[model samples]
Target: MTAKAERMASLPSSLPPFGVGRLKAAALFDISPSLFDRLVESRQLPQPRLLGGRLVWDVSELGDAWRSLPHRLEDIDGFTTTGNPWDE
Candidate 1:
């Protein structure tokens, strides 16, 4: 194989394409398609954009939305729970 072919073969194959369909978008988030739809409806995720007459999710937008999701308090650093509220 030529050097260019070798370099191309060495590139990561699992990287997502620029834009993806509904199913692919769901798979990217590791969630069911229905749940993906619910998230979209709830405005937790951005709506897909029209590309070449096809509705497709932009991977960068998905990434931004994922980063914007709320994180649990426990997941945050310097967080501590005093007493269990359930005990009150």
Candidate 2:
């Protein structure tokens, strides 16, 4: 293989499948941390696990939740254009 191809092959396939703290989770959804808190409180999102004295949401679980969201925001109960990543 060419040098570029070999280098690409040596890179990791994807990010590690692990838990993320609150800010990271919110950043993933492109929502404010406060909104993330609300989602958790309202049960719109799964409760994060408390690990080693820190709260963390499973990355895979978060990805699954994102995939499960309604294709159209209108279908969601209180989805708004405000703070929406799609709007950016």
Candidate 3:
């Protein structure tokens, strides 16, 4: 094979199409695994499905949960706001 082909082959492929393990799931959200677990426990994120005894989180479900999260805002005084700001 050519050098270019060899280099291309050496590169890692993208994430799987549907599901991912705990570490990859955490990486996807740019959070630590422990944080990911917390989110799951708090129902901020969807729980993983059991695939042959291995836990697998569905990418689509994760995306949906992430989008459903409430947006947070911080003012100049270091004050933070939760829930719908427009409701105030």
Candidate 4:
């Protein structure tokens, strides 16, 4: 299996692959629910699915998204100011 899949499979059952809400995601990131939606809209975070009007995301995707934050910000900064941060 892929690394993400393997890691996801090993997470505690309390956090399954999907079906998470803004409240739970906020708790995971220690942010407010409203802020979480803003982050999502800004593309600073992953966009979860909607189930019956409830926003949800897989724990695995959330974990990956969390880990990618720094990289994403770096890329944005590089693109905006340097044309390419890794162009050294």
RMSD of each: 7.1, 9.9, 8.4, 10.0
Between candidates 1 and 4, name the one with more favorable TM-score: 1
By TM-score, the better pick of 1 and 2 is: 2
Estimate the TM-score of every prediction. Answer: 0.63, 0.65, 0.64, 0.56
In terms of TM-score, the best-performing candidate is 2
Using lDDT as the measure, what is the rank order of every candidate, best first? Answer: 2, 1, 3, 4
In candidate 2, what are the lDDT values of residues 1-88, reduced to their tens digit? 9996896688788857488889989999999999999998998887899998989999898888889877754446676745788878
Candidate 4 C-alpha lDDT tens digits along 1-88: 9996898789997865565777888788999989988998998888888777766887788888898766433656455534555876
Model 3 TM-score is: 0.64
Q: Residue-wise lDDT of candidate 1 within 35-55, one digit each (tens)?
A: 999999998898999988988
For each candidate in the order shown, give its overall lDDT on alpha carbons. Answer: 0.84, 0.85, 0.84, 0.77
Residue 3 CA displacement from its true place in model 2, Å: 33
The weakest ten consecutive residues by lDDT in model 1 span 73-82
Q: Best candidate per lDDT, number?
A: 2
Q: Which residue pairs of candidate 4 clash? A: 18-58
Extract clashing residue pairs from model 1: none
